[model samples]
Target: NSFGSCSRGCTTIDKLHWWGASIGNAGCEELSTQLVSASKPYDGKPARMVKNLLLGGNMVGDACMGALARAAAKGALKDVGALGLSRNSIGDAGVKALAEALAADVLHPGDLYISGNRFGSTGALALASALSESAAMRRLERLSLADNRIGDEGAVTLADCFATGGARQLESLHLHNNNIGDEGVVAIAQVLSRTAMASMTTTADTKKSEKGIFRTTFETIGTLERLFLCTEGAAEKPQEDLPPAELLPPLYCLRTLNVGSNRASTRAKGALAGMAAQRSVECSV
Candidate 1:
């Protein structure tokens, strides 16, 4: 079987050709087993090495991803840097399992491809929350979440993550055809604007920038949240104003953001206009 042949590479072979010759969950099960056996003794002997696992083009669902997460937690697939799940049926449940691992710091993918899946806002929020809470940060350089339905709400959540600099190491983010609108576009534009401002300014306070264009409209809201968290008397005290860019999340390392093919809303077009005018990053929308 193609799966069997590919498994051999983890032990004692050098080949990249593998075609699943079975139907149903046979391929997934076989590959899952082999991946768990990676760098571990096989048949009383050591096999080759498999550092990355590619399981795209398979109809792997949530259950299978859960199994993979278990294996990853057990240190069976410790060296895997990439998780290719493109063109699959993974939805909210599946991504939730993956988010669990990411949240627990059990898996740190260099590249995560979940495009063409059935994930929605729930899944997006789950992943965003996990990443926001991720320890040691993600090694993710490229992330493909395009072609899903993460709507405006999900888009805002993700934008908040970027604004907070949670995924500063990320390089490319693909969200095309994700049913985004002006609200989402505007939120993302704010991120770009903040990033641009951060680049031009020398201080940590985006509002202190001599640019004179710096404003704290967004940051003002965050301040209110923090105030609400303060003790009774402390909550009533006014806090120093800061620009949203100053409170920007960890996204100093991002390079490209693709949000093309989505329905643009009138409200977001203005923000998009400024972003488009600057053309600072290699963004496509």
Candidate 2:
């Protein structure tokens, strides 16, 4: 009853905040139908204007997210800039479904929150692959994957995505409590340090008079601003075959990094701190 009312009223609305409503599979299915309906041209009225959809804590699972993913692929929710699915029962299947839409360029979210779900390396890898493959993913600004179990393998893949120039506009990345280890953190740090060097080269190439025009010249110079990696565990063994730091490219956009509560060795932590200091990035480890 209420859902029907919402569907009818949503035609004019631009955001839906229904978190913690316990709207499970059935409710999500119904909502997805409305989304598809609203996507089509309707009597010359502007199609559904929903720009933000908050459905966290609703007990939604993979099946429901799959329905939403299908709707997204069909051009529904095209205007969504922020999507919140935190604290749900989503797993790899659900994440993979959404990744398909992302890869197909049907879903472009500036901010995506999927923390506290039930996905691990497979889901993380899927998302990383999508980010690498989808040019549309460059619109992503903030991503929250904290409190899940994307371990070191997942972290390395995501780092590789950055290395490959994916998610170029991403600013904030939250990966706290994800069971990341020293190898993962080191890989990410390596990317950041390399990026910083590149930024330095650009800075050196600039004319003295144009230095003051920082924002206008280098607004998009950095790839990330804030990174969270708290509560990670130590690696059982170190990663080998790491490329020499000088051989890597530069990364200059990071500002804040949280690597506390982890078991990374003192040497690794010191190296991270030194790198952060070199880049003038705030380090909390």
**CA lDDT of every candidate:** 0.65, 0.70
Candidate 1 stretches with Cα past 4 Å from truth are 1-24, 41-49, 203-249, 266-270, 276-279
lDDT tens digits, residue span 137-243, model 1: 34556789999999898898998987775655566788899999888889888877765564453332345445545434342323233333222232123334333
RMSD of each: 11.5, 10.3
Model 2: weakest 10-residue lDDT segment is: 228-237
Q: TM-score of the candidate numbered 1?
A: 0.72
Worst 10 residues of 1 by lDDT: 14-23
Q: Per-residue lDDT for 87-149 in model 2, tens only?
A: 999999999998888888888787788998999989999999998888667667668888788
